[model samples]
Target chain A: AQTVTQSQPEMSVQEAETVTLSCTYDTSENNYYLFWYKQPPSRQMILVIRQEAYKQQNATENRFSVNFQKAAKSFSLKISDSQLGDTAMYFCAFMTHTGANSKLTFGKGITLSVRP
Target chain B: EPEVTQTPSHQVTQMGQEVILRCVPISNHLYFYWYRQILGQKVEFLVSFYNNEISEKSEIFDDQFSVERPDGSNFTLKIRSTKLEDSAMYFCASRGTSGGETQYFGPGTRLLVL
Candidate 1:
């Protein structure tokens, strides 16, 4: 079974500052996908970013990027120039490259607060 | 971009009653999934549907729970004899055929069993 771990339960970042949420996973499969999801107070799960295990190159989307260390089994999300809207619960997820049958295994999630 | 959608933002039901949560996946997506998050817990996968059948399910998906894609756009999760533990936020997600396509999720439905 695959397990995702988010070591930080809560983190606060000053406005326009940078914050990184830590994540690690336990898996034996060499081929898989990792993801970061954000859930605001509205409770919508929004895809923040994704990284394919086969691709060593990190993935970035605007202010959100990931540092994926496949060999170390670590995938951390970095939010740069954070804004107030960045306050939310961030989840780290893992899924094998099982085509369409794969299901996501998620972490307990970290609550991020972007302070004004 | 098209988005997944779920109905009834909130529902309250008595214990032992049956509850059905509905979702409308992306029009062209072929794979669908259901997940739940209890208060302060991780989101857990319940089941996945592909080609009108269950492709994968977690151990938490017991006999009391079932899923059906009765029509082209609607995917539903039914819980029989709802217990207090069943109260949680239920989210529906869908994915395109591509191997690495990210699963798009809908705004979850909050179910409360009292």
Candidate 2:
């Protein structure tokens, strides 16, 4: 089974600053996908970014990017120019490349606070 | 951009009662999924559906839980007997492709079992 872990329970960042949330996973599969999801106070889970395990270039979307070190089994999310709206619970997820049953394995999550 | 939408933003039901959460995934998406998050916990995968059948399910998805895509666009999750432990926000999601594609999620339906 694949497992994702987010060691940081809570993180705080001043507006306009940058914050990085740490995440790691344990899996035997060589090919997979990694994702970052944000759940705001509204309780809506939204996709932030994604990275294909085979792609070493990393994925960036506006202020969000990931540092995916496949060999180390680490995938971290970095939020640049953080704003108050960025405050939310960030989760790391993993999806195997095996079959159509691609269920996501998510980390416990890290609560981020972007104070303005 | 098309997105998944879930109905009944919030539901309050008595224990042992049956509850159904509905979702309308992206029009062209072929795969549907259900996920839940208890208060201050991780988002747990419940079940995934494709071709009108269950493709995958997690341990949390017991016999009491079932999913159905009754029509062309609506995907539903039914909890036969709601329990206090079932009090959580349920989210419906869908992906356009099959090989590790990104799944778009709905705003979620909060289920309160009392």
Best-fitting candidate, scored by DockQ: 1
Off by over 4 Å in 2: B98-100
* Per-residue error (Å), model 1, residue B104: 0.6
Query: Could you give candidate 2's per-residue lDDT for residues A36-69 as a string of tens digits?
Result: 9998999888899999988989999999999999
CA error at residue B79 for candidate 1, angstroms: 0.8
iRMSD per model?
A: 1.3, 1.6
Q: lDDT scores for all predictions? A: 0.93, 0.92
Q: Candidate 2's error at A47, in angstroms?
A: 0.7
